[model samples]
Target: MTEVDLQEPRRVPARAAGALRRAAPALLAYAGVRALGLLLLAVWSAAKGKSPHTLLTARWDSLWYTRVADFGYGWEVRLPDGTVHSNLAFFPLLPWLERLVSAVSPLSYGDAGLLVSWLASLCAAWGIFLVAELLYGRRAGVCAVVLWAVLPVGIVQSMAYSESLFTALAAWSLYAVLTGRWVSAGLLASLAGLTRPVGAAVVAALWATAAVHVVRDRKLSWRMAVGVLLAPLGAAAYVLWVGHRTGGGLFGYLDVQGQWGNGFDGGLAFARFVGDKFTSFPSALAGLGLIVGVALVIWLYVLCVRRGQPLALLVYCGIVVALALCASGYFGSKPRLLLPAFPLLLPVAVALARLRTSRSAAVLGGVAVASAVYGAFWLNGSGPP
Candidate 1:
């Protein structure tokens, strides 16, 4: 081999070590918050005579993912009330990874799913940090990662759910778009599509950003053209396959979601659901809280726009918030759905970054503890369905 070729292997480790050193702060903060959550969960579960591991790996949608991993689709449960819940409604990427991990290791499918989620959550934090660092600064980037980890619903990041995987793909895809890496963005968007139904947000962001570039330059490079073409194939392929299998034609995927009572009603169903909460005295507070929370979300988006954030971040965050709020089913899942919209926290992160480092650390540390307690309580009760 040439001298250059001989030197390349040594250079690879050097580059990886440099990257790890740079990312260490954000990664460490992410791990600390997650460890806090897990610790609280274990204590609370022990007190309640429940298994924390089961809560993380075997409950709620985790079970659905593991089932899909073990048995490749076509599984359904028909309830006594005549509703059919099909595993086909879920996207396939997470389960595919779970199966791959289990096949190569001694881990069970559930354990594999949890492991995938944990690794993906760390990747998601790194990607979030990179995006923030590109737009703001390193301090803002670290703050953003910490803020994401301390979200009230952050425990889902540690569970065997697709949120972390989908968020990781979405964040990196957005980073790729911001950096003008069209092909990389397209590939990540395609993978995000396979990971979750909301991958449409990533696809839309790619298309929107590409269109802006083309309009401004009055030219489209062949690479960008190819990327735009490749972006939607993953989601389209899976939906088409579902359509063929269910004999529902082009709308098969929608039909499958309909079976689960989920659909996009432009927030009408959500408004009604929130309104109905006011029927009783106790629920009226919840109704008021819902309205305020939604208003805050909208106001934050407005801040993003006014702050002159990139078009890709704006489009992605807007679509994610819209989808989360507009979905008709699972009234309790709105917060978890909105968890991946980390860009919405940029304004907060920026504000935090401007504070003294000691003060910021204190605030973040307190929030992390509170979030851990809440996560434990949530899982011990009626957690995400």
Candidate 2:
């Protein structure tokens, strides 16, 4: 045996050990930081003249979800014209989980919301960590989970919102795809579609990846074709059902949103809405802040592409962001809605890993504390209340 042969054998185990060692520290740090953030959220919510218990149960979106689980989808508020403002418009998975938790726990429908989000967010964090670790290595994965835990939108993770559930499904679904677990990926993609209309983006990414593989090989294998074909049925079936029930075409969902003063074409029109805010000083500053935030989102997406992100993840995040932004309604929820696109967390995580360990930990810790404090205040109907 020559020197070159001995060197190859030595390098393999060394590399493997190095990877395991690098990954373990980041994983431990990620879990610790998130645990602290959650504790802060609970404590802060309690201190603000509100019961953290009630805050879990009584908030606006939480109420709707509880209503859906307690009753069923056909519940609606009607306008004079008889247009159905149905809670059915919301997807079923989160409410289903709420009902499941309530059945097993002593909690009310409201507290169950918190329980579900709390558990789901941790799962989401883990799924995201695994995906990031696979793509950019363990340090980036750790950073991604930490940043996600401290995001300004972190409050919603603790709310009854579907962000955590959606993130878990999307992240793991993508991971399954990356690992070529076709059936698991497709099943997850389908359920994700049922979770939110944008779950269609996950289905699309799955199908596209399979299709690309098929085309590359010049023949469609049954596993690949079936996996690609099966992914979108969940979203399509639900949306079409909404259309049938509402007596609108498949586009009835859009019409329903129109009733709420939302529709897709007007997002660009929102630039003017932001601009007109400048007529007042405080409003001008708010508009500037909004502009800055949107700029950051756009810049992050570009960074993902420039950093040579995997094609499937990039397309998945891109389509989801575009759909969320272009949708005709609920401008206020765009930030929260886009929160599940875990790919957006990647660049921020990469940046965090570059700082000195002490500095990075402090910066991330400070953001988590601030987010927790603000989240508490906001939930209490104080600042941004």
Best prediction by lDDT: 1
Per-residue lDDT, model 2, residue 251, is: 92
C-alpha lDDT (0 to 100) for residue 45 of candidate 2? 65
Q: What does candidate 1's lDDT look like per residue over 37-103, in tens digits?
A: 9999999999999999999999999999999999889999998889899998999999999999999
Over the stretch 238-341, how does candidate 2's per-residue lDDT look in tens digits?
88887888888789776666666566673675677678889999899989987898788889899888776766687799988887666656556777778887
Report how far off residue 98 is in candidate 2 (Å).
Answer: 1.7
Regions more than 4 Å wrong, model 2:
1-47, 78-84, 382-385
* Cα RMSD, each candidate: 6.2, 5.8
* TM-score for each candidate, following the candidate numbering: 0.95, 0.86
Candidate whose TM-score is highest: 1
Clashing pairs in 2: 262-328, 262-329, 263-328, 263-329, 264-328
